[model samples]
Target: MNNPKFEIFKAKNGEFYFRFKAGNGKIIIISEGYVGKPSCVNGIDSVKRNAPNDNRYERTDKTDDYRFNLKAENGQVIARSSEGYTTKVNRENAIDVVKKEAPNAPTEDQTV
Candidate 1:
C-alpha cells in the first residue's frame, strides 16, 4: 500500500472505524464483529490488541459481532467497537490501553 497511514472515522451508524494504510494506500478496515467486541483495521494490531472477550480475530460480513485489533508502532492496541452498539470499555478506555501498550506509538492518529 502506497502512502499508508492511520485514519479514524465514524460510520453512518455512529460506530467507529479505523483504516490502516500500506505503501499503496491498500489497507484493512476492521470493525466490531459477532463476538461483541472491537477489531483493528491495521495488521500490526491484530496481535497486540486482542479482544478482551476472546482475544481472536474474525473475518465476516454477515454479522458485526466479531472484531479487528490493530497495533501501534510502539506496541499498543487499536480496536473498534461493533456497529449498532458500544463496548463497556468505551473509546476512552481503548485509548488508554493504546497509550499503555504503545507508549511511543507513531500511529497515535490510530487510537485504540
Candidate 2:
C-alpha cells in the first residue's frame, strides 16, 4: 500500500513549495512559497515537527468553508490545508489525519 509523502516542487513563478499528499494521492496540506529550496525544505521540516502536536493547528471558520493552518512554535504558518472542507467535522478529520501521518512521511524532491 502507498504511504503518505511530501513532494517538493518549483512553481511557475520560480518559488519553491512543498505539499503533503495522502496515500491516495490527494494533497492535504501545502506550504507557502519560498525564495529558495532550503527555506522550502525547512518548512517541510517544520511541518513534520509540528504535525504531531494538536495545539499547533489553527482552525478557521470561513463563510463558506472550514480551513486550518499548521504553525511552528514561533506562530509562523508552516503549511495550510490545500482546500477548505465543506464541514467542520471534515476539517477536524483532516487535521486528525495530518497529526497521524505527517511526522514520518517521506520527502520526494520533484524540483529536479
Candidate 3:
C-alpha cells in the first residue's frame, strides 16, 4: 500500500500551502496559506500532532455534503477536508484515514 504524503508549494499569491494526499494521489486535505515557509511547515507539524485525535475533529454539514476541520489544541483550524461527503460515515472515515496516514507521511517540496 502506498503511504499518504504532503506536498508543499508556493501559491500564485506568493504564500505557501501544504496539501495532504492519499496513497493513490488524491488530495485528502488542504491547509490555509501562510506568509512564510516556516509557518507552512509548522502547519504540517500541527496536522501531524493533531490529526489523530478524535476531539480535534470538528464536523459540519454544508447543504447536502459533510465536511470536517482538523483543529489544534488552541482551536485553530490546521487543515480542512474537501467537501462533498454524502454521509457522516464516509466523512468520519476520511478523518480516520488522515489520522492513520498523516504521522508517517513524507513531505515533498513542489515550489519549483
Question: Please, what is the TM-score per model?
Answer: 0.32, 0.95, 0.93
Using TM-score, give the best candidate's number.
Answer: 2
Query: TM-score ranking from best to worst?
Result: 2, 3, 1
Query: Model 1 — which ten-residue stretch has the worst lDDT?
Result: 28-37
Q: Could you tell me the TM-score of candidate 2?
A: 0.95
Model 1 Cα shift for residue 58 (angstroms):
7.2
Q: Candidate 2: lDDT over CA atoms? A: 0.93
Name the runs in model 3 displaced over 4 angstroms. none
For residues 50-99, what per-residue lDDT tens digits would candidate 3 score against the true structure? 98899999999876699999999999999999656988888988998899
Clashing pairs in 3: none
The model with the greatest lDDT is 2
lDDT of each: 0.39, 0.93, 0.90
Question: What does the lDDT read for residue 18 in candidate 2?
Answer: 96
lDDT of 2 by residue, 6-112 (tens): 99999999999999998878899999999999999999999999999999999999877999999999999999999999999999989988998999999999988
Pairs clashing within candidate 2: none
